[model samples]
Target: MNWIILILAGLFEVAFAFCLGKAKETTGNEMYFWYAGFLAALSISMGLLIKATQTLPIGTAYAVWTGIGAVGTVLVGIWVFKEPAGFLRLLFLTTLIGSIIGLKAVSSH
Candidate 1:
């Protein structure tokens, strides 16, 4: 389904963000490797997004895509990169998730 594709695309978006974060923390060959991973993930994410947009409304798809990426990246930051997970941060994340779900529920497709 297109929704599944969209979700995978969003996941890849998070993967690319993770690669960028890792690249930022490394050097030389390792850094280049991470950058390569970023490029690959970016390509795949974009491709899936384009595919999903064929059936899903562009606005809804894009918002959901970015929402998933934002939520996922933030969680990745907390778990992998040891970023802050304060109360306000989590509260906003929960809201973002709700918004994404609401968009999906309301979508005509």
Candidate 2:
């Protein structure tokens, strides 16, 4: 259950990250909406992270949460934002993913 919540938090973190850029891209009313969404997502993500830390090791939980968010945000950047996806970037991303998996495997819960 905690893991599920943490994953949702990570997804929201990714959403907020994208919303940050979208907010910057727009003007006036549109920017306000995006900013509001970013704040909401950020709040939810932080709350879930705090909850997950109650059971999971803080270091492992934080690493996995940020790992998910980082990987997700990177994918969004490459696909939706039209950012460059060079070989080195993908390689490091895969490495980070491997580390996340390793952390999960070693975690007792």
Tens digit of per-residue lDDT, candidate 2, span 1-109: 9989888989999999999989989999999999999999999999999999999999999999999999999999999899999999999999999999999999999
Clashing pairs in 1: none
Which numbered prediction scores highest in lDDT against the true structure? 1
C-alpha-based local distance difference test score of model 2: 0.95
Per-residue lDDT over 53-84 for candidate 1, one digit per residue giving the tens place of the 0 to 100 score:
99999999999999999999999999999999
- For every candidate in turn, the CA RMSD to the true structure comes to 0.3, 0.7
TM-score on alpha carbons, each prediction? 0.99, 0.97
In model 1, the number of clashes is 0
Error of 2 at 76 (Å): 0.6
